[model samples]
Target: MIVRRCVGLLALPLLLGCCVVHAAPPRGFDVLHYSVALVPDIAAKRVQGQQTVRFKAEQALSTLTLDAGTLEVTSVTQHGRALAFAQAGQQLHITLATPLQRGASAELQIRYHGAPAFGLTFAPEREEVYTLFSTSQWMPSVDAPDERATLDLAVTLPPALLAAGTGRALPTRTLADGRIEHRWRLDTPMPGYVYGFAAGRYQQATQQHGPVQLRYLSVERSPAQLRTVFARTGDMLDFFAERAGLPYRGDYQQALVASTIGQEMAGLSLMSEAYGQDVLDDADQIALMAHEAAHHWWGNRVTCAGWEHFWLNEGMANFMTAAYLQQAQGEAAYQAQVDGWRTRLDALRAKGADHALVYADWDAPTADDRAVVYRKGAYVLHLLRGELGDAVFWRGLRAYTVANDGRSVVTADFQRAMETAAGHSLQPFFDEWVYTAGTAAQ
Candidate 1:
């Protein structure tokens, strides 16, 4: 996820800390898939839903816990039988009808309804958008970055509206009530945060790029402006694929929404509506496009184990955008992008707000914490690339993505890949840039 400006600090009262480490799922189960059925009432600003989760028990467990926000859960059941459940704060705990023994697979279904306070937006005037970390606001799941699961989502809404979500779209069915139900299937496992949907009156255009299909959705009748903004998408897909030594995994869909924040999901990306209008001339928006696209390989495919190593996601995306600019535009354009990040970092240091890239204080990170994590994190990658040289650096990156595809990783994972490719220890480089605070050495 990338934002143009810092919003208010994140305060998640239910979780012990706002960081990923504290919010990790229990080790007893591995979620395999989720089937979510949602009926959203735009005028009422509420959603009613049912979710069935399939998982394999890694250890003997009598109870299961999932992260669900303030939604009102009506019932919990297993195999058509009612099961005892408890909801406290953001956690929903359910006792198994029979203990799930080690290596056994099981399924649980939950029914819930609520007007979500976050993660989902109801805009009867424009479009309904779901932001990152908002998945738990509407659906119950193990809401952590490390836990990945495939999804099947069915959304019921007014017949006039269209629903765009993760993965490929299935045939639309009209219910007897005259509402339309759209189903989407995401067979590739992804972190819970990336599962989302947007429903509203929309105009969609399709473009084919080799085996990957690109779908662009917008509220405007003519999405020519959006098409212009994403004109280079095919070239980017080719560039990142060649650079990372990985082919595009799934079909890509992008939506222009009502917010300024941009997010990259499993096979979908969302950009603020402004990007197609007033922000069209902003070069940063172009870079933002490339950044979000690169996340398919960085953040979506190979995720960060925890927020402490968030740079493994955002930093690589940032650097990869610059690398693409260098090839597509010129070296000057790439240097300008790097310089912009350095300027942001220098300003943070002027205020004595500099922090390490690993960010030890995971509970609460101020605005400066965000800046360092993004800007400084990109700078660290820039330095690493220079030290390792282009040939070795690119090779290591490709190796990293190839080896860790579909898995959660840490900073050490990246460091080890680079060292293996460069045939030398990167300990000193990591120590100064990632482990230590303040600016990179001149």
Candidate 2:
């Protein structure tokens, strides 16, 4: 999160409204891995890359397509042999010379050059660069949140700057052209939307919390401020792990850049310089940080089956921030946070702008629709906690999270977990609150 990935859904008009920008992946195979090597021209805002995709076909197939937003494909090859390819609209149609049969596997190396339309920034003035959303904009690949695969990134940049990304950082090497290539690998499978990178001249500080490595980086703020602002990093991790009964064993990082982006990748989180300043002003401005950190459990680990149940990711994260407040900042602070959500929910209700937390279509959403996902969704959790005793509510959450770790889930999956803990059906409660425009006033 950094800014909590609502994306300018309020201020800007989006066709998909923070939903899937990636089209449905071609229907024959599952993507197993992606090896992306990129050379970004910071001054020109142009990038060139070689994308190697490995997949296994479930059925016999001779052609496939990938969502390649405005990329100009130069070549497509298998091993050393060329494959026929064409760029149509936002898709790259690749025709396999050697057709894949049922249960067969193949790899395609696609070379492309283009200026990214969105999701990546190259601020040459400040000498910083980062990605926000739309992984397809930066790399020509599927951006669906449910499509999971391993990744390897090789970003070539100047030797002096640093690079932080989605996976474990491997050794850096000097390319023949004199630029330094930063390499990273994600051995575990994660959706492409969580694949990203950030590179700049940053002052990095690292610490170890249990088995997890906690790294903090900043370009504008002093190293002391970087540590000061993220001092609660380890505590948030401990709180979430304790609450979920699942420890985060991987490395984590928070890098401050120019934009107000708080988007989380697999292991790296890009925060904004503005938020760091806010933390400097008030050390207790940790709610936003807490919300993003909570995504490590709800959003990134146990993803929504689809964007339709995205509240399972965002609403749960928002409510967990309040839960952390209840623990760290006292019950009054937690009640105040809940009261703020109530205010927002009441406002939405007043405007007749309330929408179901479990929305059906993400066609075009108003800012209030987005608010319902964050505020009303959290309020419903507060209501659910009230209905089920504290012990049962927490037990249900632990059951749901532990059972669906590293898996995709829908709203019903959560409802069943709560019902199991309560030893009774909560279907009536969900039918009234979650399935409809929430009961904000009641």
Candidate 3:
């Protein structure tokens, strides 16, 4: 949810030039040259990676940093020649022996190792490994939601392990000890947090429909549950295609992972193994699946331009999931979810903690703030749709998806698309829901 910023009415010049202009970070790697080797042990919760980032510097720089976390750099090399490198905490500082010129491209290769520490608040003595919340724990780049770039990666894993990530898996060769070298080529640009890696003993089931391929990766012992999980995937794809005006693209697959969380990567979604096998008769679990399915369009396709636009991702998912349930299970089921969300929203607002649906920073919000963002954000879209009517609303959604496909999007962009579709401006509504805090006027 939006963190308030005090701004003067006459500060338009500075706001236009500096504040909004520097919304996202400057990517260190260019389109042409960069490579990574990310190796991980899922059972051990340990990761090691080697990165070779090549970019042209526009001016002489005293320091260059890559977003890293708790990494121990083993070696640094520049163009096959050795170079001195230093690291301070999460920032890897490279002190070039000489100044790099404005027109020169430089290659810096770094080898680093660390087990990600995210949901791990205890000592190693208390627990063997850390359970990480974000994917950035495995490797380093500018680890932010809005930070996006294409990556070429080669991963090595045990022979028995099954690996699924955002990228297309390249051919692998068996190592002498029976381990495998799994190479992946990520042609699409992806957010740092959306990149993923999950490995375990798995059974991969594949189905083909003409040129489109549907795959499900689950652990070795869950064939019975796979029947139900994979059964809904094809139908979900068809539903999204009809609503979003396109089919899911590029190496479509899903992973039934070991953890109790499901995350969407570019082409893959990691579903918790527990959820896969456990009993979930509730609509919430089904809604979660639908929510992740919506991510292919909302989160993966038209990404948030910054953390401030996080509502673009969660709000869309929440709305789409309810829509999916309505289509599949009829209006009653959909209205139930909507009513529940509204009740939650009301409770959050009553606490005097209603936050703007879009947040300006990447930090996790407090529980009350999270409730407001997730619930209120969805309600805002519902209200907008009601105002615009079904035909115009759906048309605006299709236009929005098509116009901003595979790119970062902000609030103004969506508002403009909706305005065009409705044949009138919806600026006041957006301003109340997205720019200001507290309850939107009824």
Candidate 4:
């Protein structure tokens, strides 16, 4: 999800970001998988759904909590037997009939129906899309960035519509009632924010880049237009892989539904329909593509531990995108990108929107804070690279990605990796750039 400051509003205090330090899976359990079956009623702008969550108890417990948002809960069952459940706020607490022992595994099946509080979108006149952090709006699961789980999604929609979701698509099944069920499975565990589905009358185009498959899903643009817009996807993937010293993690990756909101999922990304217009110049489009593609390694593979450390994901992606520009376009282009970010960041601070990078209020991050998080965050990394020099900088980055693969991390985790690679302390650098407000010296 793109972070834009909420203008004309006072920003929340930085202390609020501390309140959600433990906003992950409860200590007693770990989610293993999620199976969601949703049928969207586009005419009514609602969804009827059932979801099953399989989890393992890390400690004995008689109750479990999952993020279920505000969906009306009709019934909940465990092992085919009915169980009592309560919906409180955005959380669903289920009472187990028997106490689950540590290390024991179990499943809870939830039946419910309602329009999503947010996330799922139904636009028959346009397209149905789910943006970031909206996964819990339609289904019940552990919806936190630190909590990762494999997913199996079966979305039933009109037969004329095509759907794209996270992971690889399974064989499509047409129901007798002129509805189609599109199934997708993600074997690799991914954070919930990236879990999503987009369904509409979309045309698809595919390109193969070694073992990585690239699919473009769009309704407003032709296949050729999509090719022109995303022509550098394969090269970006190759560039990131070589630079990070890690192969792409998933079998296939998809870019779906045009929107101005550009977000990175595990193996998928979303582009806005504005891409089809001549509004965004080629350089801007390429930069956007490169930024999201770099996220496959920075944001998707090595996720941030919480919203507080979001820079670990977005900032790294921004830096990597600049790195790509430096290589593909030239040093002049790379320097211009860095200068642009510095200029924007200086403007935000000039307007009295000053916040520390590491401690920025994530609870309600404003667009001004986003400037610091995305642009200022990139500048921090750039400063570090300059301090460490090219040889150690790339080595440190590769080591950081490799060390944190398939895990969530905080800024300190990245600092340790970089320090280890450079064999020197980076505490002063982080303190000046990340922990304190104001721009780093140019």
Best by lDDT: 2
Tens-digit lDDT track of model 1 for 209-229: 999998887886366766776
RMSD of candidates 1 onward, in order: 4.3, 4.5, 5.0, 3.8
Candidate order (lDDT)? 2, 1, 4, 3
Evaluate all candidate structures by whole-model CA lDDT and list the values in order: 0.80, 0.81, 0.66, 0.77
- Determine which window of 10 residues in candidate 2 has minimal summed lDDT: 6-15
The segments of candidate 1 whose C-alpha lies over 4 angstroms from its true place after superposition are 2-25, 127-131, 278-285, 438-441
Candidate 3 clash pair list: 308-359
For residues 314-429, what per-residue lDDT tens digits would candidate 4 score against the true structure? Answer: 88888889989888888987999889888887787788886677663565677887878898889888888899999998898899889889998877788888889899887677
lDDT of 4 at 382: 88
Query: What clash count goes with each model?
Result: 1, 4, 1, 7
lDDT of 3 by residue, 1-442 (tens): 1222211011111122111222555444332344888666555666678887766665665456666667677877777776777767566677665666766677778888876665211122212122233544456565545556777777677676666656888888787888887777778777655665555566777776445577777764355556556666667777877778877776677766545455676777666656765523443357666777788888877887776667788788889888888888889988887898788877777777776665553354666765665677788888888888989999999889998887788777888889999888776777666666646334
Off by over 4 Å in 4: 3-26, 256-258, 278-284, 438-441
TM-score to native of every candidate shown: 0.92, 0.92, 0.86, 0.91
Candidate 3's TM-score reads: 0.86
Which residue pairs show collisions in model 1? 119-134
Cα lDDT tens digits, model 2, 175-286, are 8878899999999888787888988888888888888889988888887888899999999989999889899868998988887547878888777889999999998888
lDDT of 4 at 185: 94
C-alpha displacement of 405 in model 2, angstroms? 1.2
lDDT comparison, 1 vs 2, better candidate: 2
